[model samples]
Target chain A: MTTMRTETSTGAEEVRPKSALEPLISAENVSYHASGRQILQDISLTVARGETVTVVGPNGAGKTTLLRVLLGLISPTSGRVTSKPHLRIGYLPQKIHIDPVLPLSVNRIMTLTGSFTQEQIQAALEETGVSHLNGQSVFNLSGGEFQRMMLARALLRNPELLVLDEPVQGVDYLGEAELYELIANIRKKYSCSVLMISHDLHVVMSSTDRVICIDQHVCCQGKPQYVCNHTEFQRLFGRQFSESLSVYSHDHDHRHDISGNIQEKNQ
Target chain B: MTLLDDFLWRAIFAGLGIAIVAGPLGCFVVWRRMAYLGDTMSHSSLLGIAMGFLLQINLILAVFVVAALVAILLFLLQRQKQLAADAILGTLAHASLALGVLAISLMTWIRVDLMSFLFGDILSVEISDLYLIYGSGLIVLLVMLKIWKPLLAITANEELARAEGIPSVPLQLIFMLLIALIIALAMKIVGVLLVTALLIIPATAARRFSKTPEQMAVIAVLIGVASVFIGLFTSLEFDTPSGPSIVISIVLFFFLSFILPAPKTYVLR
Candidate 1:
């Protein structure tokens, strides 16, 4: 069972309160049971306008399930999710298998919603650095290229909220940083709230406004720095993992793994 | 040339009209990997034929009604978590075929050539059959053209289409009804056994050369028309069965596509 309510704006005080504005999206203690297994526990999070939130967790931790619940693609077994009325959400799924028999060009996929003009489609592709691939078959795109194409398609709606399951899943390490940076720029450019799932700790540390470390439920969520230093995060990811991320965060030039010290790839 | 002068011209017109509708609808069947679903619908159409014979109703109307009923049943069954789609389809396909064959056997009032229902008698197509083909074919084509974008969106990615506020359930139901309607119309051109081939093969052949979905649909229609012409000519010259002959023509075109540079591809199912 789920319920959603929209309240009228209360009287304003002399000083404007940030809380007065409704959140762009929020889930309230949502729990989901699927296939007779509990995929998600009581989980709650909120995304305000213009905030970039990243969810990080070990695999099989119901991150995708949580995203689907938040997206209203599936209903939770208990609790509810609320959002601003008539909110437009753009979703970039983890992986979409476009049938090879169906011939779809990059430009064609962007206008799938039928709301974009040719110029708008071209501009969105250009914005994502995939303008050259406008006429290329969607099936012919490489993983990184397809990810960018999906981003371009998602941006066509001019969504107030963008939800990406894994924005840079198959991208190379360098491409990963560049894509995250591109996402940050897109957030600033569109001024839309960005929600994504990621495994790149170093990239997420610098890119997101808030990092929610979830394993079945919210382990901890706050500033990336705070979450990185939290005991729960350390236990889940390990002390060594957070230390390496911290080192990478500070140096910004060298790469390091959880078990090893900094190693300069260029030098 | 008089309108009913030769049966060959009537056969050509009937076959071509069926192709006009089957081509685009077949492309969706191929794109969505619903070939088995097509087979299931066509197979169950035989049950509709049997019931029509028993009740002395219009054969075309009976086939349409039964096919639509099976589609609705499949839709409801798919909602239930117990059975996989293929399992349900397999049961329905064979059960409907057995029941249809049994029902046909039980009727002794009129001698029915079972082979004619299994493999079509395109050579004996009446002028009235042409009217049914063209009239219903036009409606299917227009409705398909209207729903093409949303249908393609749902076929490509149901979640994405739903996210974009596309009415997926209604679109899917409409798509199923279109397939049922086509299957009913196509029974005379290609019997229940060969109807799926008419829908899938030309579409597969068109995929080799197409660069866009609209291009694919158009090319598929051309391939379908060409197959009908070739198959009918082959039937005349070689004394082969017309329904199977058309499917063979389509298969030959699929093989002919080997000359094109092979694209790196994967089958959905």
Candidate 2:
């Protein structure tokens, strides 16, 4: 099994360039409640520009709720969220059930936000690798094709923040890896910050800059490798994934190839 | 031979006006699966009629007010979380129907034709009724046109719509009010019992034949207008009930839709 090796730690007291350090969105102790039951506790997070953050948690872990709150779909019960003004957000839901009665083509769905020139629409679809499906009915597209089409739609607005909620819900394992690679490429090309919720922690960690482990609260957060070694995360997900777990400790935790081994350095 | 002088001509014009508005509105009803919501508003028109008599006000206006109030009530009740939406609609529909009947029964001074209100008296449509139908129906259509894009977005996926900055709450309230207005305008033509039949059947038939929301809405209007003409002519020849005759024609069209091949190319606009 491939393992994520920790490399750099950004949170450490070290000199960092000011222009590259500002966060695109920051939540200061946000909490959400529905009726009397608490759905989200005092949680905080920050996403910087041109970085990819993956939220990992069990079912009903308030991941979706956090995304909705960040998107301003629902108000937090208390605390505050500060975002860069005029933040253009591109959101892709887990799965959109477009009514077959509506007769929506893939190209037509792009026009839902407003009018877009044909060339611009073509460019976005091309970027997402679904250029040929521009005229096809959205209902007729396969699961992978649909996700790409949705990504195409989200890319049309030239969003600064791209938010995806469970992008690989029904995708096959191979397709899931390819889609994450595609997303990473999109982030690099657009220089946009990405916030995504995913259950496939194993594959996504390679592309992710930061991983937040949450269950009704922000249980642990840091670089992907650091969060993977968190006690709370192990307690929550360790039962089903005992063998494949790879623990790597480093001074400055950052990106690393999964195939790299940590045992040689320790020896 | 003058259009205003003949009651049959007046009935035809009134039914046509209702169809123009009801068809597009009904497409939304079918798309959102709110046929029962439409039914609830239509059924409550009876209580509106009873209120009209008690207040000595215009019947259509009273019906409009009552249906609008019921729409608001449904909105409020929906927030309670105590009862499911279908249950609330069912309870409201039956309760209002019973109360209207009771109110009519208690008032001995007014000689109300209960069957006409229930089944509608298309033959009895006055020239004044035609004015109300066209004027109000025009407003409903215009409002629908203005809100078409956002309403379609909401119907397609409400969470996505909200995330995209559409004001879903106001749009929903406006949609409910539009349904209420259509019910009030259509009550005299199709009656309280079959108003939803008028909205639903034509829209459903059009769905099988249309390639776009706009196409479906336009075709729904065509189907609705055709049903009205067919039902009216059939009533004149067969002497059957006019409202039920229109509903039967629409039902026939809906069934005929199955035989026609579904449209292949979905036009974007």
Candidate 3:
């Protein structure tokens, strides 16, 4: 399940910042280069109401860079980004590391907002079915538990736009299935737009409505089903993509696409 | 008490005042893992000290101004098109320290027991320095209390904090300002090299004894206070330098905490 396309380079300079367009996100003529490497190119992109955008590309294709820009963590070399007001944003990072000696636990992490009451923390842990871990040290949490803990944290924020960077990394088969199910349920309950970086094509493909193939450029953008059948998806990524063989977990030179390509090209 | 005793009490008051203010802000430095950063800034304060002597201005204000400028320079260098934040901190630390030492050497009038100032003898504190320490520290601590929540948010994740509408740039400036204040006062008590121990070791020892970050911050103060007492006594008995004596006491506590068999689990809400 993959969507492919050609035309990998495009500049997004013409984007306007009109706040009334019902566009959750608009990136116009954005370009970014990190460590003398071209991570993101001049690209125009937009996400609208009820849109779930999946960014996919080979390893180092600037998927992370685009996400950083969306999160306002990194400034683009050139380009203007505009977003709707107070866009209840929730983000799940690639991984959470607490240094073990930091004295942070599951409950502490879940209560990160600090604006939340104890009852809210209890409710989030209950919803994520991770109440048992409330007392556990974060260092002892398994990969799946850690992921669910992070999700529970995001839920505490009550965000309308959920952004996750590779939520299903290093998880067991049952855990992965449970994760996807949990996401579907969250979307249904909250009716929030979901933007996540994932490499598991077999799992995310059928579920994603919008697919944007980014390979240091805008390769293609359309509905997931259309992308799965597109000739462009076939040329760049020909694999049928088994569920067991995921991205970036292997020891060899692995390439990752959170459905964002990880392609490294010097700008 | 005689007039000399009044002066002694004033110096001690200055010491206590600085400890109170630095206790909380120092915890943040430890939380952000910026202990070495505190040392770097404290070292930069020497440049300000030298400038104060050369320019014939108030030493405290000069130290604050110069160290704060160094902090701003650090922030700008961090945003450099090519340099990383860590690299900028490294270069500023060394360059500023050397310039400070060189500037100090140029002043012949600065012959007043330089070793005590360097190693924290605390015998020369004036009434004005006491007032300065308490007043500035109180204001800084009050500001810190007001912004504590947002500060914690930034410490967790900078980008995430900004996305949630927290102004990280301004917050970073405030953080650096508090750090500069700490450097200005702590430089006298800790010497530039030893100030980081006050920020890091207390927090490090506190981590084993507390559950949440807030609790750790509080415990760090207590731990720091304990080390101060131990150090003060040891220095009096052995006639050793107070700065190094305090650091040694801090290290001793750390070792003791590590060697003692800790509980299997601790519950912190």
Task: Give the candidate number with the greatest TM-score.
Answer: 2
lDDT for B75 in candidate 1 is: 86
Tens-place lDDT digits, model 1, residues B1-269 = 49656888988998899888888999999998899999999999889999999889978889999999999999889887878999999999999999988888888886887787788887657877788888988999999989998999998898888878888889889989999988888888778799999999888998878777888888889999999999999998998888999999989989987776755542222
* iRMS per model in Å: 3.8, 4.2, 3.9
TM-score of each: 0.90, 0.91, 0.85
For model 3, residues A108-194, the per-residue Cα lDDT tens digits are 776555577778888888888898888777877888988888888899888777898888886788999899889878977877788
Q: How far is candidate 3 from the true structure (C-alpha RMSD, Å)?
A: 7.8
| Residue A52 lDDT, candidate 1, scale 0-100 | 90
lDDT of 3 by residue, B226-261 (tens): 777777667777877877887788788788777866
For model 2, name the residue pairs that clash.
Answer: A7-A252, A8-A252, A8-A253, A8-A254, A9-A252, A9-A253
Considering summed lDDT, which 10 consecutive residues are worst modelled in model 3 chain B? B1-10
Q: Write the per-residue lDDT of candidate 2 for residues A10-112, one digit (tens) a residue.
A: 5555345635455778777889899888999998999888888999898998999999888877778886777766677889987788878776778878878
Fnat values, one per model, are 0.67, 0.48, 0.41
Write one digit per residue (lDDT tens) for candidate 2, span B91-164: 99999999999999999999999988888887678887888888888899899989999998888888877778
- Once fitted onto the true fold, the runs of candidate 3 whose alpha carbons sit more than 4 angstroms away are A1-22, A34-37, A239-267, B1-11, B84-86, B267-269
- Looking at model 2, residue B2 earns an lDDT score of 86
Native-to-model Cα distance after best TM-score fit, residue A148 in candidate 3, in Å: 1.1
